[model samples]
Target: MKAFQELAETLSTTLAAHGLVLRGGFNFSAGEESPTGPSNAPAKSVLLVGQTGSAPWPHFLRWWERQPRDLKDPLDSWSREVIGAVAYEFGARAVSPSDRPFLPFQQWAMRAEGLKPSPLGILMHPEYGLWHAYRGALLFDREISIQAPENPIHLCDACIGKPCLNSCPVGAYSADGFAYETCLSHVRGPKGAPCRDAGCIARNACPYGTEYRYAAEVQAFHMKAFAGL
Candidate 1:
């Protein structure tokens, strides 16, 4: 336990310097299959890494300014570079949401943090609301003492009106599920200027984490990327 705490502290400090946070972690349960790690060994534990609200905005902006404008998926690439170094130094293996085989990040997050998906599918933290994300994970060969969050709070349950469900101009999200082509087409045309200039209207309507909402520039950057502009 001491060793795990020490390792977590050291890694958390390093990640903080880069605008990332150790969202949380957990040890694999007995009989559970674990993620593959160094040398193809099954990892015994994992620490989820990510950001809250605009935590990574400024840092990512600085890093983005240094890379070529045509750089593909700069955010994912940057996460790989930074977390990969952290993994090397700590003798752990790095995995990302974008990795091939598509590790079950959403499941891992739900288990570690006791968070459930909001109507928009982003994990809704009682504190962060809809403004948090899981960027990467660090896999370890040894078990780490960590606790799963308790008494999980699903804010959407108490959120009457559910403004998020009604804010979109194209009615892209509904009980039937998301209309992907509808959303994409809308954002790609001139009719989408407002959505293109800002972030998702539905996302913004989620009032739980108003204080943690992304800055205009940060939201604009993501909007452009989502619209493939």
Candidate 2:
């Protein structure tokens, strides 16, 4: 059984090598404790999450520059390759928690050997604000012991501007809560002011993630996914 500290160091180094910055709350667990749908079988695993940095644009540019200039619309192969490699290397399964029901899936991940919150949303680093995301997650079968992630600090709590809330042209995200349908309509190319450019302006205005900006193509990809396009 590989210990958690050993695993963290390995993953942190790997992500750093790829230009990603490892934020707080790098949670890991045995495969026996991971999220699984009611019908989906659970597997032994561990999860590693971190910010992909401010410039995923360069990643997109590099991917784009790889093929013949005439070829357009890069394939999903690149994402699959990146994600798959992480999964294989870590002796764990990999996935974004959002791929399933948000709350339940997260709970499943936190159930001791199941699933757990990255300590105070520690994985939810304040710097990238919420603009960054866990680009990939790995699940492993081996039991690896890791130190508790650093206690998380909610950066949003300190912001007077509350830019993430105000920046939304559509006002999709409200302190009261999100209006998903309205946001969905606008991103799907609905006639609206806020989401015209693919996502929430408020999110873009977030100072935390200014460095780890999402590439335009990644934003488009996410917007299309959100819109169910």
Candidate 3:
């Protein structure tokens, strides 16, 4: 079998064992530096990104919720561990963006590759809604070629009301963009209702992922962590 096929199988087995159900539409691109030219970065040298499910992220989410307001630094370790495993499997490294070494993937997707926009941004998938978060990414060392699908399966195309855009209490998300301060203030207020309890109303309003329900308790846990409540 080719390296790409092997990598896919290995990823499927590894993530499935952890109760993560890998879906289609995982777009892989070449890394910044490679033996071959940028245009020639084989599909094999890839970045693995997918949504969470099969095992609910709520267990982790809930733990994050109850953490004392001041002690959340430990969660960063968990993030590294999860992202690292996938990187190792692919003989690649995990790149989490920092203040330095700003990522070019988003720009590459838009300018060079010609994706209309980020897939998740459009509410295209019915299963994940907006509740799903892109937690980690994996990068491979070598290049390999895989067949590209003819067209992207955009799940958000059918929705008319676009509940995700409207559901937010603060209208943080819209065609325009997010208002970070407005969202942060609501979640952080001493007496305000916690964002974790009900979840991000806008995210919850998505019609996708019937099987992937965001439990309220889990939502509250995430909210408290995010809001520092």
Q: Which stretches of candidate 2 lie over 4 Å from their true place?
A: 1-3, 16-45, 54-57, 60-77, 98-124, 189-194, 215-217
Model 1 RMSD, rounded to 1 decimal: 1.3
lDDT scores for all predictions? 0.88, 0.52, 0.53
lDDT for residue 36 in candidate 2, whole number 0-100: 44
Instruction: Give a tens-digit lDDT track for model 2, residues 1-229.
Output: 2566576677777766554443333233434344542224554444545345444446645776777855533434444356566656755555654454442334432332222222123223544445554454555544345444443565656667666667665677765677877777767664643454445565667666566676655666656556656
Candidates ranked, most accurate by TM-score first: 1, 3, 2
Candidate achieving higher TM-score, 2 or 3: 3
**Backbone clash total, candidate 3:** 11
**Tens digits of per-residue lDDT for model 1, 1-229:** 7886787789889999998999888988788998876657789899999998888878887898999999998999989999999988888899999999899999999988999888877889999899888889999888887865795769999999989989999999888888989999999988988888878899999989889898877787788878788
**What local lDDT score does residue 168 receive in model 1, on the 0 to 100 scale?**
93
Candidate 1 residue runs with Cα over 4 Å from true position: none
Per-candidate TM-score against the hidden true structure: 0.96, 0.64, 0.69
Which candidate should be chosen as best, given lDDT against the real structure? 1
TM-score, prediction 3: 0.69
User: In model 3, what lDDT does residue 226 have?
Assistant: 73
